[model samples]
Target chain A: MDLFEYQGKQYFARFGIPISKGGVADTVDQAVAQAEESGYPVVVKAQVKVGGRGKAGGVKLANDADEVRTHAGNILGLDIKGHVVKRLWVEHASDIEREYYASFTLDRSAKKHLGMLSAEGGVEIEEVAVTNPDAIALIHIDPVDGLSLDTARSWVDRAGLDEPARAQTAELLVKLYTCYTEGDCDLAEINPLILTPDGRVHALDAKVTLDDNAAYRHPEWDEFAGSDVEDERETRAKERGLNYIGLDGSVGIIANGAGLAMSTLDVVNQCGGSAANFLDIGGGANADVMAAALEVINSDPAVRSILVNIFGGITRVDEVANGVLEALERVHISSPIVLRLDGTNAIAGREILADHLSDRLVAEPTMLDAARRAVALAGGQS
Target chain B: MSIFVDENTKVVVQGISPTSQGLYHGLRNRAYGTHVVAGTNPKRGGEEIEGIPIFATVAEAVEATGANASFISVPPKFAADAIIEAAAAGVPFVVCITEGIPAQDEALAYNRLVREFAGTRLLGPNCPGIISPGRCNIGITSGDIALPGGPVGIVSRSGTLTYQALHELSQQGVGQTTCVGIGGDPVPGTSFIDCLGAFEADPDTRAIMMIGEIGGSAEEEAAEFIATSVAKPVVSYVAGVTAPPGRKMGHAGAIISGSKGTAQAKMDALAAAGVTVALNPTEAGEAMVDIVRKLG
Candidate 1:
């Protein structure tokens, strides 16, 4: 779950990381008020989850209330890489002496926590990694031992930070590590962590991606839920504990696992049909879950046909068939549902569904055949 | 010899109880002829799950039953600690079927194993475990869909897709030596490369089929390994070509962030490595069949 920049800044502040004084404005009037509160010379930055806000004219510097209102109005509705700006982050502009980069993320290859600190900042880290690899100081910390203040100081030294800013930057790195670990962030990046003429250091930008798996531990994460770009179908599916993604197509997909659900979408497209949504019932494909999945997909106006693809692993197919039958009694689906059940009592499951086979409820032996049938039923690709 | 598990592999199930999902699969594995020797639960120390003895700790379970491999099916909160306990108890290989374990816990478990228990290999904290078809079934993969004594070896990131690849191959009258689900998480105890290297070393396995999805460089790294290290015929299928950017797409690791970890990139990497990259699972299975026919 990616957080808006303003939210990230606020999150960093929660961990005692110094951030520029800022206020989030949802309206143009609020933007002017925020600029006045910040004492002018504020940066009216568009709050979107994409990069190049400056290039897209979404970022502007305002010296006064009039300038704040003008820039805020222009950036509030501006689109950066297809993300329409609905919020503005008005922050007091910093006096930058130099820019440096710092971040903490998982090193999937090493299966460890990786921290990168670079003297070079204010640009994509990937570019620096490719062009001047030595410019970035790479450190792999064990999640068990995490980052230490002493280790962070040497890392800052390795990154060739100025002597005056070294201690503050090192201190900030420790705090950021805490934010990454205790905060349950998948990534905590501060590009262009600025060094002021007064020898103070602070995060000029924050890009945070929280780990959704850790939401169970932190109920406070519910506050970040408002920024999520979820649709009605997704919210309904979430209510039923089904993993569903809304897509703009005619065929609705229901599968047993993540890999299979994604492959189901690809197969539907291969059969010349687009999917309306991607729904994974996971291990429990019981009556209530099946009924809830059907109700969510059935609500989609684009859905013309549904494909139920279940391959029993921990999930038993015969029981899943019974669940589907029970689900049919609860939810009245408008479109046809093509069922393809295999693995673990699949024959018995097929035997159970044999009596219910009809124009509305059909079963195919193979996923390819089931997908083809679903696509044909949905009137093919548009 | 099969990779990971074979007839000689004695198994100890952690967190197994009469009503737990661990016991449920434990019975199924025993029914399939696996040596589900002992179970460990602190609370149910003397209790048994369908005649399988339960011990208080993995050390006791391992000592009593001589179990070399451990299968974990604990809840999310305790799943990592279970893996750590199994590894600490000298279980050389641990496969965790429990899902929703926090990334921090998984990372801690993974790092701890690599550092302290260098000999132990953890397969997953949230995954469908491995099956060496007709020989040993580890976790939740349905043994009925698997066929034994064949040339093809399979490994996948997705559970159902792993089964789908097996079903697609078995339906075409082909069989697999072993099929492994590495689990679709940000940090898996095992990787595609681990299973690929094992398959490459196994003489009975002639060809390999790999199923990958979006997120992480596991697929790309597997491609590099296949290009340089592996000599067997490799066919691959990468899911999530249609998955939109920045969405979770069900799996925790199955998301496209920014411009990285796309299906196309992984597929391109695999193809460049002489892997038969199929656009879909069915097509991938068919490609493997073609490879098998040519080998014949």
Candidate 2:
């Protein structure tokens, strides 16, 4: 659901928002050609789906095609936040007159479409909101209606945008909202809705996150899924349709439901343990989903201990136990497992688990006890 | 009396007919005690699924069956409009089970129904809906998780976690009054604070089990509300305690953007408000039961 910066810019360009002319290059030769196409004074940015790329040295500016080739070769295989740079976005450098931030997203509390505009751009909006809340103008739009030009203008003006830039910023803001709604974006932001020296407003940087649920409507999403960029564990998990997200920790957690998975991670942390990943088997912890989840977790080298926390209802606890047993037999698990099974058919689930009791599998009767056992085992303190 | 829904509630099904979701609803409703008044599908209007009459619109269905509440099983794109139609037709409560409604549409529906109409209450656009044990199982949540006679009040941000929490409570012989999944969407129709206030006012609810997640200030608001408004013993568990900042996990509300909505912050706020914070979901059940027994 997250778009790389280049793709975001491409999407913005469709709405008449000016972006530094850029094209994605796959190989070193292609990148050299792209740099030449864009001419000198181009920025070659590593196409990784994470932030702080600049700080990570993934973004480089080149004076000529020779420097472009050097930087492109260095960045192509470079890793940023565990994601390898396979492609680079080659863009013409920009001269900024002023920098500002504008974003549109749904605000849950107000239950309305909210737009955030700030004169302070090129920095995290959260910082602006915290350090100087007044520096940003927050506008709530009636979802049934839409963001209006008048409201958008007022918002830009309130954020202290100069009159000449205010009209252009307001015009760009409405276009961004239109793009957001039409593109099915959960978030469409221009961190620096830049103004050039020529009095022209352009999106210097585009960051768009399309709503995953809305993918059904946007059939073109399959092309932009970026399966190759995802981690091996996540890729495999996605193939099996299991909800798995990798984290940096030692304990691997498999819990029913997203909340419980997250809660399991919380419990592990509270007990002095950190979870390596979050795997939610959703409502039904059937054999296939459970097996897929376990396979995904077991694939992670960082995982030292596994925690299977199930509060069974529609998903039978006994079934989940059987699935765990099945997954263990199929996969070569290097870590110890702490099991917590409760709710409907919990007694049966425990009975099934008890039947196959081993040193590797420790069945805890309660969540607290399970968490403690899992944390200790992961930390090698058990 | 239970919170949100109880045994006395009459239920109507929206978008129920020959569809796959309708068939599932038919089988589930037959097992649960929800008074099946009418099912609505234009193509199959006047038809009966397991003896529940199908009507064309929410207005006709409510008028014909005298239904005050509706269970919406429509597709995601149309789900919001369905809730709006039900609300406009004077249905006080509409539980939308349609998953994956866009955050924008969900926001639009919630603003119009709950904020605009005083009589209307919306549960979810992507949730399992509400379930009242021994009375009526109106939503998609499993009935086996409920006890016929219990007093614990449950509210959660995730549907599966609600069931998970209920399973834990049922295992401990800690009966519950009603369990509500307010939906994990950024623009859920209901909120934990709203559910908590209802549970606090309910005489039958001996204790409260609140399940929260990182993201937004909902948990903090709940803690603030609990600090002064609620008298019942509240045992809480917040997800994403160890979640990395700004990462979007599976649940919509489990994103930890910064220092604002970490699980630790929510836990701290709840603890400061005198609510018992369960380190894990499993302990949440046992903790609530123990608190109620001690308070009693």
A276-358 in candidate 2: lDDT tens per residue?
88888876787778777877888899998899888775677889889888888878788888899877688888888887888
DockQ score of candidate 2?
0.63
* lDDT (Cα atoms) of all candidates against the true structure: 0.91, 0.82
Listing every candidate in turn, what is its Cα RMSD in Å to the true structure after a full C-alpha superposition? 2.3, 2.8
Which ten-residue region of model 1 chain A has the weakest summed lDDT? A226-235
User: Best candidate per TM-score, number?
Assistant: 1
Instruction: Give candidate 1's error at residue B234 in angstroms.
Output: 2.2
Query: What is the overall TM-score of model 1 with all chains considered together?
Result: 0.94
> How well is each residue in B117-185 modelled by candidate 2, as lDDT tens digits?
779888876677787778777777878777756688899887667887787778777788888888777
Candidate 1 docking band: medium
